[model samples]
Target: MEKITNFSVRIVQKYLPSAFVLAVILTAIIFVLGITIADQGPMTMAGYWGDGFSKLFKFGMQMVLVLLTGYVLAMTPIIKNALNALAKQANTPKQALAITIVVSFICYYLNWGFGMVAGAILARAMGSSVKVHFPLLVAAAYGGELVRGPSSSIPLIIATPGHFMEDAIGIVPVSQTLYSSWNIALTIGLLVLLVAFFLLQKQPKDIIVLEEKEEIIETKVFEGKMCFSDWIEHSRIPTLFLGLLAASYIINKIISDTFSLNLNTMILIFLALGLLLHKNSASYLNAAELAVKAARGIIVQFPLYAGIAGMMTNAGLVTIFSNAIISVATIKTFPLLTFLCAGIVNFFIPSGGGQWAIQGPIMMEAAYNLGADPALTIMAFTWGDGWTNQIQPFWALPLLSVAGLSARDIMGYLVIWLGISGIAIAGTFIILM
Candidate 1:
């Protein structure tokens, strides 16, 4: 096991390009695929690529905030202290990996943004205190995303009213999808597989722990008499007021029973909690400054991915791909095949909402014709979208940034879990759904 893992890590580290380079490479490859498969002209692909940049611009910024807000929330003094306490629990490498996976999976099961940032930061905390293979540890942090299939995002999309496909399939409520027996079973089943599989991977001898940095609290010390401006800088009143404003709306959301724990609401919650926990403007802004550093990777790389999505959709590649895969599906095979199709498409279009916009309609329509259950189909598509994320670099940006590792540093370990999860998710859909 150790030899195989070492070989995989060595090969990926030697050959895998940086995430940005991989995005550009994916762009070029997609451009060519557009020409060959979709028979799109170069100008057409370029047009799609350019236009598609705007498609994900808003979503990209949302991701940036996801990293920023999540980071800011994680950096608060209370959270930092909590992480330090948690870090002390793991004395061995195996224990470190196990705890990281459990923590990450739970966070991911709650909100992708929280899971993505907190998991990575926690891994860093663990690496600092425990003698573990840092890459494998980070990979375990990321592996928690496996639970997103049922907890949020893709499933939430189809369940919401006014979704792109709602007019056709009607609104598939959360009770039918997220809260279903099959989905609950699959989620639990996959998590067990993820934990066991992650723990089994061999740890490396050459461990890379995080470099110690200065304390996060940054106060402007004025030895002389303090001025009014300096007084405001240290004031907690601003944060108190800000927290109250955000908290009021959240209160209304829960009071009305409208809070779905969706990504948007989760971000708001993070913002409110971050502000309240920081207690003062100085600590809040200090955390914000460092949060930007962690968010930089997400800011630059997402547009490239958006353009890739544009190319795939514009060139009709997503359509072509989805149709080809689902065309041959039977009732039992439809769910599994749709999952298979989604996993393949996710490499090019990593965004769950983006893929669902194009492929969701196709698969949902195909499900109706084949007599496959709509909710089951949704779960299958969700699994496929997340399944390939094991090796996909786009979604890993935020986690990798906070963990201070490159994509190659972790992808090798994830590649193995990708297969394990593939079989588990695929088998669940086939046997049960």
Candidate 2:
């Protein structure tokens, strides 16, 4: 076990440099382009970076909500106890993996933020007995992430591409270009992908085996625990939690409402709530600190990505790429093409909203010209944005960092699932087409 732990540590150390280097190079390239070309002006690069920095607090608030949800769920005694029971009931890697996937899926469907929390709580509740097989435990959480789909991707699934098509072109296409049909195909594809992943995962031999050593168990004994009081204290914050959840829903709705005024309202509400719930000065300070920590990942990363996207779009990179796609792609191939393009772009632009902002215009145009379903085009984009996340380093960072693991440790494990997801998405598109 000591050897295995050491090996995992080394792998983490090795990967950290690579991840950091990639981030720096990507950021630099984008900034250079924004300044030198793209006609963004001399101050544009600085403005982009500054704007990202300023929004750090808002980003941090989102992160705090994510962490708090996860932390609170983990802290629940019932969940902890349940995990202990499960660990004793099913002792092997296969059993644990199955349980993890089911739990993750349930949690994810509830809400990705909360789902992550629930997964962490369950994993911790299982205790040291389960941690004896750390790799399996980690894999379980990751499995959930893949199965959950992207948060932003969900919106595209329901949005009528027809609306965008009308704006892009004067006349609507005769056939539904890509709405419900594409969704159905993608759903079926994802189901098959999940099955394949399950089958492939049955063989534990493929997993990297660390040198076995003596197990070190850490057990927490709950003796004469104040069950009632604990429950009340924990549940006391539900008003705040529920209020936040509702606000989140409203914020999402307002952002999607097309009236830009709602964006300002949403921001104001977020700030006010942060201040209100913060209580005393010390607590408020703490909230502020937490918010900063939470926002770091998004704030640091988003601008560079946005700039890259801007450059690509301005330079006609997407037009050039999409044209190539159109040259060979037939009307019957619309669904597949949409999926492929969405997936490819997702690698560079990880955010669903961000990707849509850039790719949506071009895609809508294509759908109108080709006599395809606009809704189907949106679904294709959704599939592409989500399917690649399993392999994308950006989204994996938060989860991995929280789990005390690095990308390299899990990257190999995700390879099969990523391929499976891609095929499922692509296949769905083809079927719909």
Please give, for residues 1-433, the per-residue lDDT of candidate 2 as tens digits: 3344345445654664444456667656666665555556646655665554433344344544554444334333444456567667657555655566567555654445445545544444433444334444555565556443333332422333444334554332222422245444454455445534553443333444323331122222346765865444334354456446756766686788742222233334444354334323333344344334433565566555665565556555556666777777777897688778877777766666567766777777777788887666666676677667766666655454445555666665565567656776666567656
After superposition, candidate 2 runs with Cα above 4 Å error? 1-18, 28-89, 124-127, 131-133, 146-295
Q: Tens-digit lDDT track for model 1 on 1-433?
A: 5566667778998999987888899999999999999989999999999999888776667666766777788778787788778889999988888888888888778767678878987888898888787888999999878676333577777766677787888877888877888778878887788778877776555667666554356777789888898888788899888888999999998999887655566677888999899868988898888777767766787788889989998789888888888778899889889889999888878888777877788888899988899888988888888888888887787788777778998988888778888898888887875
Q: lDDT for model 2, on a 0 to 1 scale?
A: 0.54
Q: What is the lDDT of residue 405 in candidate 2?
A: 53
TM-score list, all predictions: 0.94, 0.65
Regions of candidate 1 where Cα sits further than 4 Å from its true position: 149-151
lDDT of each model, Cα atoms only?
Answer: 0.81, 0.54
Best by TM-score: 1
Error of 2 at 167 (Å): 4.0
